[model samples]
Target: MPATSALRKAKLTVTISGDVINEIDEIAKEKGNPRSQVMEEILRDWLLKSKKMAIEKDIEAYYISLTENEKKENREWSMIATESAKRTWND
Candidate 1:
C-alpha cells in the first residue's frame, strides 16, 4: 500500500479454509509481515487483475462491433505505429 495518511481502515470478519489460512500465515512469516498486510496485498492484486480483464473484454467487444472498413483502418494504423516504433528503436 502507498504511504498515505488519508487511507482509512475498516474491520472485516470472514471465515476462510484452514489450508488457505496456513498458506497465508507461512507467507506472512517469511516476509515478516502481518497476515492483514498479506491479505491486503493479495486482494489489491486481484482487484487490479480483475479490472484489467474487464478492460480487455470491453476492448474485445468494441473491436467485434467495428465495421470491416473500421477494422482495416485500425490494422493500417497499427502497422504504421509498429513501423514507427521499430524506427525509433533502431535509430
Candidate 2:
C-alpha cells in the first residue's frame, strides 16, 4: 500500500477485562476526561514514545528496561529487516 493508503484511521471496539475497564474508568474520572479522550491521550503517548520523541530521558529508561528478547543483537539494518518481516508476517 502507498503511505496514505497505509495510514487509514477508524474507530475500534475492544473488549477488556473487567479490572482493566474499571481502571480505565477510574483514570478517566481522576483526569477529568471522557473515556474516549483518555484513550486518545494514552494512544498519543504510546505513539510518541514509540517514535522516540524529545524525551530522551524517558526513552533511555525505556530502552534500559527492555527484556533480552526485545533488544537487537545485530547491526541496525539487520534488526530493521527482521522487524519488518516480523511485522509483515504474524506468527
Candidate 3:
C-alpha cells in the first residue's frame, strides 16, 4: 500500500534544481495537469519500481545462499528430466 492514501495526505518538502522544476512543469503542462500532481504520480511510480527492485535483489541473495550441493543436485535433476523428455519425444 502507498504511504499516502485517498483519505490520508501527508506533507512533503522537496528541493530540486531550477532546471528540474522547470522540466516537471513542462511535463505537467504536456499532461494538462498541475506540477504537484505530476510530481506525486511520478514519485509513486518510482516508489513502486524501487520496491520491486529491492524484492528482486533479496530474491537473488536468497538464491545465492542456497547450499552448493543443493544447487548442483537441482541442476542435475533438471537436465535429466530434459533429456528424458527429449528421448520420449524423439524427432
Candidate 4:
C-alpha cells in the first residue's frame, strides 16, 4: 500500500449497539472530539494492534518451523546480544 499524509473521509452507514454508542459518546465528550473522531481513533488503534498480533504470530510460526540446530543458534545469538546490551547499559 502507498503511504499518504492525508486522511480520507468517507460516510458509512452501519448499525451499532446502544451500549457501544453510549461508550463512544462518553469518550468523545471526555476527549472533546466529535463521535466520528473518537470512532476513527479507536478503529485505527485496533487495526494497528491487530496487525502487530498477526506479525507476532507469523514470527512465532516461523520460529517453530526452524530446525533444532537453527533454533539453538538463534538462542545463543540472542543470549550473546543480551549480554552485550547489559554490558553496554552498565558501562
Per-prediction TM-score: 0.81, 0.44, 0.68, 0.81
Q: How would you encode candidate 2's per-residue C-alpha lDDT over 1-91 as one tens digit per residue?
A: 5798657766889887999779889999999999987887888889988667657878789889977766655356687998999999986
* Candidate 2 local lDDT, residue 28: 100
For residue 17, model 3's alpha carbon misses the true position, in angstroms, by 1.0
Give lDDT tens digits, candidate 3, residues 24-84.
9999999999887999999999999999999999999987998999899989999999999
Ordering by lDDT: 1, 4, 3, 2
Candidate No. with top lDDT: 1
Residue 14, model 4, lDDT: 81
**Residue lDDT tens for model 4, 45-80:** 999999999999999999989999999999999999
User: For model 1, how does the per-residue alpha-carbon lDDT over 1-91 read when each residue is reduced to its tens digit?
Assistant: 7667548787899899999999999999999999999999999999999999999999999999999999999999999999999999999
Task: Give the TM-score (vs. native) of candidate 1.
Answer: 0.81
**Clashing pairs in model 2?**
none
Decide which is better by lDDT, 3 or 4. Answer: 4
